[model samples]
Target chain A: MDIQFEPLQKRRLDQAKWAYTTRRINRDQNFQLLGGTLIPKAGDLVLARVDELGQHQRLELVTSRRASLYEEDEIVVVYGNRYAPDQFEGIVPDHLEPCRLVAAGGVAARLLNRHDRVKTATRITPLGLLADDKGYRINLSSARLPKAEQIDHKPLVLVVAGTSMNSGKTTACANLVKGFVRQGIKVAAAKFTGTGAGADYRALVDAGADPVFDFVDAGYVSTYRVHRDVLLDIVMTLGAEMSSNKPDVIVIEVADGLLQRETARLFAIPEFTDWIDGVVFAANDALGAQAGVSWLSARQLPVFAITGVLTASPLAQREAHDICGLPVYHTNALAQKSVSSYVYSCLKFRSQKQSISNPVREEVG
Target chain B: MTDTPQPGKIHCRTIEGMSQTNYFVYIPSETTDQRRIFYTVHGISRNAEEHIHGFIAQAERYGAIIVAPLFLKENFPHYQQLGSSATLERADMAFDHVLQDVHEWLKIPPSPMHMFGFSGGGQFLHRYAMFNPKRVARMVLAAPGWYTFPDPGQKYPYGIKSTLEWPNLKFSMEKFLQIPTLVLTGDEDDQRDKDLNKTRKIDCFQGLNRIERAERWTAAARALGRAYNIPTDFKMESIPNASHAYESYLAHPPFAQQIFDFLFEAQN
Candidate 1:
């Protein structure tokens, strides 16, 4: 039987770019559109179909251009269940089902867990894998990783990480890029991980970097349930791609909170440790700053300075400084060229670029 | 997309005379009263499967059929050689024969095709449309690395005249000028890539990069229209912040809604 389908409108998933090329939509005897809570994972892309949309709730549907949003009925693409903490969470079971919209930015996964403040998830159905001309599934993991020589010549890297979403990660990172540019240093900025979004990358570019890039450039829309190795590949790809310009410094932002699934796993890798020269940690307040600093300290990771939402409050800044015993710079202070000087001071004084062998072993051991 | 799936099939169509077996078409489940068609060309990647997606939405909405033909380097090598006389297979004739095969395959009469191409496709369309203006309704020459300028002093591809003195790349000015065209490229697409042709002759005639090339063709074409008595329908646009990629083009601005408006002026 010949089946005709329209792609989900405003598909936020960059993978949706291949929706039209997907030739196969076959299913098994057990293939019933199940109303489910299983979030999509790697294996889920194999051969899923659109599950029935029975429940009524808000659903976030992003378009192919990353321009706007749409309703649940508007999107038509194959997606898997997600099990990430910060976004949606659930198992991508053997059966097909209707998963909730765990992320508004651009991911559809089942919700198994969420923080209390987070709202109800939007619902969606998975269409299935978009196969290539040869009739093979388009594997996100199979995408190319940039060669080591592509990213080899970076001057130095200053990573800005946050304690939680909306903890002023973008604010801090953009200002950091501005500060470095004001100091007359050529800066290339990047956001290696995250579900794909245009604003953050655009914001970073607008802040004065010659150009900016994110995970979307490498293919996967959102990094939510993306494989760990793919995340490493993204880091390498962005590193090599951004290094093409030969900037004097490269400032990268690791999306979501420090403890978020992908970022946490990425930080655990030794290549990540050896990749960056300094860290500028961001947090909401003193407690978050202390927690973030403690987390870094426990891993023997070097912290350059603490900045973020807590910097907006004088008392929170003072408390964070006292508690973490680290230099605290407000978002405004970071915007000033003085922040560039401070980072330079840290890189100059410390034995930067520490060579770590088997960062996974060091973390586990 | 929970509603009933549209009654259309997006399938591949084989053209026996074509360079590759990879051309595809999206015919809506049903046809409207009037038949309209689009012939889209792919970039250097030669992936018609990927380029076809850009038009599937418009195809369904306008009841228009999109035929995306993949022109391989093996059959059509070099951005300029395909249309110039220095080729084993003349791209202009390839397109003509391919469409004849398509019309036969679809069992439909010939219709004025709306031609569109991106990057290398843009190069093919501009020169092809210039020679086959009667076959084309309107054209979009987008971000071609360089163009075939209206000049006899310079070389072919870069300019119409060549030292080889092969078949003339010339056409009637009034006929070509009347063909509605939009010559466009990204504003930030000025980088010198390895593939960018930088021979001293090309650099001397056309300016520097893609950005300069777009400006050169727009100005030259419009000027040619003015020199003759014909009214030029040619216009130029630059998508800000985009550089040699469609994703960045979408990000810099919402060029989609604008594109739909341009392509469907005849439909609407």
Candidate 2:
């Protein structure tokens, strides 16, 4: 199969005055452009001066290669104001100034025009540009978002909840995300219940949430005492964000106890239930966690795993498996490579089964 | 300054990257250098630091390292009922992270680790012990709220409550019976009395007196141990003239001495 790289109309720049400069390509510092140039072809490398070294000295570089003809160790060019014939090492530092370009190789070369510039725009939020001149704007959000008319290939989502406030739900969700991510599967993570805190989202990201969102991003101070309708809206918004990522799996974390008015209401919502593929119950110990699983089972929710605070011990793991009949995992157990790998295998198997069972079909004629 | 035994100062470190502000105190042991570590969970108030100070004074007498991790109200929004994921996650992470910290500080294998929860703290400790039974050498649960059996339909002196309705009830009794447990409560504890008063308060569905709950827990543990044939040593006791609060019990020489003796007793 031929690979093609389209100029992603996005650019990122870093400004540093004098001292040492770091050269980077595609956000990686390992690759550097050595100073040299013959002809700039469709996919040919070009170095443009991006920053001032001292007075007359300018730093320049071509960091990316066109989709075609780009080899791992292919050499590019770095142009500086003061060029040394024998020494190109004086310019590229540990950090590089940001620049933008369109590369064409093979099929990409045919699609490129010599004067074609990647159409880049400053991301303007309602609050205006985040930075004026110095900070480079990088579009972190993916552009290949799933469309309403397009068939949904995204993995089914599963959100878990506890009975009260400290029942291990977030840990379970994070562990599940980590497990899925380790399987080379992309996963989106979000907290569907409770007031938003940045820590859980960051933890989820660290655990391999390709994209993570929470109630805080939705402009709520906290989910405590919020109306059922408002909570559902926030959850739906998160689901939409996850869907946009087109992840192989989505893990939603519900805060507080399952019996809480907010949690119960969120779980009972038809829209939320339909999106969920399975539920995982996290509790402090084996007993309460089992009770939580039973409650969900009674409501006919397909619970895939029963994990909680106790997973740190093998006994708890065995007991959970024996009693709940669901695979058990401990959040702290992720620190162990063997346990993490095992969890990944289980989740991967489930994800593959889900895909096979529900094949994505194109729009009917 | 005089070398007069300085009441150990309470130290609090705010965990970075958590939504609610949670704190844990390091109580240096006053006795032996063997370095015994215990984590105390606070009751309804979720004030772990206070409990740490209280336990530190007691711990100092025994020369055991005491760590009181305060599960703050802010951290656990639902003060009365703490089954929420936020609360569970916070507790799990706090304990998980704190264990690492404790291991680093003690500079040894994480052994002789135990958890003590009084009242609301007892609820948390029981759950913590239940979840991580292997790591814990002993669990001292003083007036815990809930106890479960294999069958949810069984009735007890406290009341006939169904364990099925309680959250996190998925743990097996066979596993629960394996851990060595010490259940204690005050004879005159109003909570136990209240629990006895409310007949429908089974499975933590309603509140009960601390004494009645303790007795029921003892019976349940004994019954569970017998059923599982787990040879578990579950002890239940009521300190005379002491209410639900450990302050009174701790103040009385007989009660205090008994507790200290029980806690320090060798576990083979």
Chain A TM-score of each model, in the order shown? 0.72, 0.52
Candidate 1 chain A lowest-lDDT run of ten:
A20-29
* Each candidate's DockQ: 0.00, 0.02
For every model shown, the clashing-pair count is: 24, 57
TM-score of 2: 0.37
- CA shift at B218, candidate 1, in angstroms? 66
Q: Which parts of model 1 have CA positions greater than 4 angstroms off? A: A1-73, A76-87, A90-95, A141-150, A219-228, A348-365, B1-268
Over A293-365, each residue of candidate 2 has an lDDT whose tens digit, in order, gives 8888788665656567766665665566556655555565543333434344334444455556665422110
Q: Which stretches of candidate 2 lie over 4 Å from their true place?
A: A1-365, B1-8, B29-32, B78-82, B85-90, B148-172, B190-208
Chain B alone, TM-score of each model?
0.87, 0.75
Summarize candidate 1's per-residue lDDT along A13-90 as a digit string, tens digits.
333322210112232112222223333344223332223332223223222233233342343333433444444465
Q: Write the per-residue lDDT of candidate 1 for residues B84-119, one digit (tens) a residue.
A: 354555766666666776677675555577777888
Best by lDDT: 1
